[model samples]
Target chain A: MVANIRDKAAIVGVANTAFSKDSGVSELSLAVQAIKGACDDAGIHPREIDGFATFTLDTNDEIEVARALGCGDLTFWGRSHYGGGAATGSLHQAVMAVATGMAECVAVFRALNGRSGHRYSQGVSGELLTADAIHWGWYTPYGLLTPASWTAMITQRWMHRTGVTKEAMFEVARCTREYAVSNPNAFFHGQPLDRDTYFNARMIADPLQLFDCCQESDGGSAIIVTTPQRARDLKQPVVTVKGVAQASAQGQEQMTSFYRDEISDVSEHRIAAGDCYEMSGLRPSDIDAAVIYDAFTPNVLLQLEAWDFCKFGEAGDFVLDGNLRPDGRLPTNTHGGQLSEAYIHGVNGLVEATRLVRGQSVNQPGKQVDHALVTSGVGIPTGGAILGKLD
Target chain B: MTPEEQKAFEDRIYAYVGVKVCERTAAKDAVNPAMIRHWAEAMGDTNPAYTDETWAANSRRGKTIAPPAMMYAWNQEGFTVTRGRASDPQTDMVELFNEYGFTGVLGTNVTQEYFKEVSPGDTLYLEMEIDSISERKATARGIGYFFETLATFSDQNGEKVGTQRFRVLKFIPQEQPTAATGDDKLEVPTRIPSPRGHDNGWWWQAVDEGKLLIQRCKRCQVLRHPPRPMCGECQSLEWDSIESGMEGEVISYTCLRHPAIPGYPKDPVCAVIKLAEGTNLVANIVGCDYDDVFIGMKLKGRIEQVDEKTTLPQFYPA
Candidate 1:
């Protein structure tokens, strides 16, 4: 069982570099910039940081980022895997480190040149040498090469079983784009999406159009985790880490897990949600806002079901009923999510979730956000975290 | 034709149902390793039980056993398939269809179930009957009538070993469309090759020789795919292999359309196939239209040399 660490750690600062298609800088420079910005927000010098956590896919190394930031020797350093699936899992590592007194301050960061460098949308190309390449080899020869294609395999089956159509998928895209229209940091800002344009967009994979996919941006995001007592003296209002969890179910794969008994279900999300809720003593009804990963529009709907916000097969109706709007029931992705916002993998969603808990969102919901839920990517070993105002 | 004439034609075809296409015919040769090996190679199956004498002697089965899917090989007529065959109901029905101008024939479906295992020296006999005939229906190919045949096999001791059902469509050929005259001819791109590595090199080598081998733990008998060195179920370093039957159903599928990658069609139907041997692999659904693929659609796979350097398993509707 996961040890209860509710309110034990706090995120005192959250910062992100300008989201862009091209950064014109190295990933190490982005990392240093984001980390310096986060430390500045917390009213601390970069040299004060003593620990670090990040995703394994991050090109920037820990010692290099620490050296560039002039940080002291790191005591607690950790990294998680599966790309965006480990976005919050990296934070979970920091929370554990701070709560257990292993480190005084831990900075979790993700920096990438996803666009101008190695674009994931280009699909699998060149030779793959990793062990993960073995299973990927099974599909690449069949022309199932892209992340969108892997996701569509499950989305297609989900639609078949639930009788949902592209209309519901469009609602998810439209709702997130609505938030992006007002969020100045979002890549889709000021670019409103109409149903005509969405329907006219070329298909990336069956059931997934170009608009449904997330923007591959070159950007960086950082968060500072420390003891709740130490966070009370920070520059920003303390936002408590009420709960955090990472889980992988049986037969889990990196987005290609089709062998499970229910191919459409996100079992890892279910396990992680169960642990997160139990740890925080919160339920789906307690969450006022959510930053569910939206690498693709269909993921929002599937995650809505997996998180138990609504029962399975009802997310189509949930989104179509306008429940994601500011005055609506859930008010999801207020920062536009990865779909409309720049995709920093998923760490950008974490920054938005932190903003929601701090009551500083540009498109904050009308209701008070006492607790906000944020999740990493699905279709792999994934995780979720809950943030709330310090008691 | 008028409704009455259509009904008359359907009735005449339906009359052949329950007609014996073949009486009990003995196999020309007994089950042996040479034929088993040849069958395994053709089907791309590399189950050690079929050919590895030493491994089979030490394994649980204790001796060599033919793959259960090879039951039909024993009864084949080989080079003289047309000469030694007698006039049967199946031929008469085909002749009748040909006379009516429903001349194009296509094998659409086949399913086999095994009961008793057949090993070396087992002589098999076969009996077949026309199972059913459907009314003429329009299909993507043309207007066609479907007929099913069922065959049962038994060992020399007269115990049942297996049974097979085969379905074929006889149709009138559709008018061929004119070939494209555009100068923008689509160049066929070689498929992305499977990444052969230290762990999975043997599996790809088997595919080169037309075989699909599944890594199996020698101790716990657990099966692992993509050829890993360690079995997840049991922490065993010792392992062997079993050849897949290459029979499966589409558990899930997708059609990729955007950013048209090289080495593929405009839209290719890719599927996750749950093999009959209780494992799954991703492969292309070929030999059929993309729209025809569905969850739970039965399929049969073949290891084909798709490009200059790529040999992969491609599936067809079964």
Candidate 2:
């Protein structure tokens, strides 16, 4: 059935632009820059890249990015829906294309001037578009406009179910910022965030403080993928795609599944995480480092629990106990995560996982990261990957 | 930065918690059709409920109503007076921050929770209180203190309409107010109830008359909270509304802690109710701490006259 395409493909190269609030360039330029950089890093001619993959949020289309990269006509072009939930989906498509002999070289990229172009935190200026707008029409009058508002609804229940206090989320901000202060690439570089400061940062949404949410950074990231046999001759170490999966629960609504029995459930990520584990034959204990998505502070906790890294309703304590630290149980988001690094739609976390698999991460855990679990954006339809050293 | 010094400092800042800052300040203008039109023009909103009288009359709202997003417009101190009096909690808090070299102030975020609709002639009165004050901290901007204020808006009859949670950072910025991340004069939207040609216009009409009406199916004698045209059990089209004591129990709930909702901060959507008769409805749990609310708790529904267009059901511990 080809249910598990284990070790069929490997990530040969990855590149990320400096994360920032304003890039002062078009999203198209960002995509081209990242794609070209990845191709160069992979030592692959632009023409060798025939497939294009990315999420729905990016402004640039596959045809435009492919054309811009001078990567002749594309044979495979696909995108995943649900904003950041499709972070690993681009890689999943790349893997499927290469494994099935549909395409030789696939370039997975995500580029968006989130801050300069579509500042999500400031709220939208125009009329609501998209068919989802009609569904949102039912809740907008209640003030559920921004993504944070939708998350706030779920977070409320998650808190009630888990007994996880708002205080526990602050630790995520502080820890990620602590790592970010050390990395020059982080928006909070040189800006240390202590627990008290994190607490003092005003609440944007209930349970979610200002720092609890991720920075709306403008950035682009790309990963190069090909058949594991072909990747043997690539420029960088082969970070074999051990497993990849995407999933959605029965009652999944982008972020608002308010009518469900368990409103606190992030079952989509759990379902995706299960697929990754089943396909890779790697348990949670087999993972050395993880790059859990941190679009919001609580998202990390939810992903940690959803992926079975910690018990359900116990991620808050796992995080508070310093488990996600560089020296802790599992060094997570060593690139400072979307919370501190950048929100490139969770692609940056995948880049970090690739780096970990290559043993080239800037903040490499004291113990080398042989296997890393890279999760996409949580709290919605989600996807994930288990990246490991090419054995 | 010393712990002892920080302790003393925090102790002093903590003294202002829960203090009533602003005496009831009336909105400069009562909700009126002209004000609604002005808001619609500013927003380029073409919603018939906000502008067209004929369309709104035929719609579920029965008449033009103010947008929930514009809930704060009525209470805005805009270009007029009451821009934080000297003794007001807001002014005092700012002054307190200034004394600590945190002379600059910028809004971090704001959250509103809307419960009901507001329309013409609804005079809004706002009461402000110091929700919380954080310990001093250093940032890229400079040293700062974040203080949050909760403002409750009600009408002349003291029926709460909404609440607003405003969090502001009083900082000595390194530069001018961190160049607003692309704030190109876009007014945040005010939400109004989506009144499509809903089949239950009579129910809303009854609410306007200060009555809590539940639709009853004549064929099978079953009551429904949301008035649907046909009964699910009997497939009956004939139905009538009957007034009940408006009592229920807390079944499930969510606390909506959003920065800014269209209306005022009704904070924590509170609870979903399983009514005394039958059927479920969502409403806020008031008159008690939100954290204290639990499933199976006895609750009684209190309908508040939010405006000429809306009467909202709010639940309190029975």
What overall lDDT, based on C-alpha atoms, would model 1 receive against the true structure?
Answer: 0.87
Q: Which consecutive 10 residues in model 1 chain A have the weakest lDDT in total?
A: A122-131
Model 2 lDDT, residue B87, Cα: 64
lDDT of 1 by residue, A94-145 (tens): 9999999999899999999999888888677556756677778777888899
Interface RMSD of 2: 4.3
Model 2: per-residue Cα lDDT at residue A131: 56
Docking class of 2: incorrect
Q: How far in Å is the alpha carbon of A312 misplaced in model 1?
A: 1.6
Clashing pairs in 1: B44-B210, B44-B211, B44-B212, B47-B243
Q: What are the runs in model 1 whose C-alpha is more than 4 Å off?
A: B1-189, B217-223, B230-238
Q: What lDDT tens digits, residue by residue, belong to model 2 across residues A1-391?
A: 2267899998987888877788988898888888888888889888899898898777898888877778786789888888888899888888999989888888898999998787776443135656555445444443445667567656766887789997678777877887788888888888888877788877666656778888898889999889889899988988898899989897677776554556677889888988899999999999999988888888888888888988998988998899988899888888888888898999988888999888888788889778999988776788899999888
**TM-score for all models, in order of appearance:** 0.72, 0.68
DockQ of each: 0.45, 0.17
Q: What does candidate 1 score in Cα RMSD to the true structure?
A: 17.3
True contacts kept of each: 0.78, 0.25
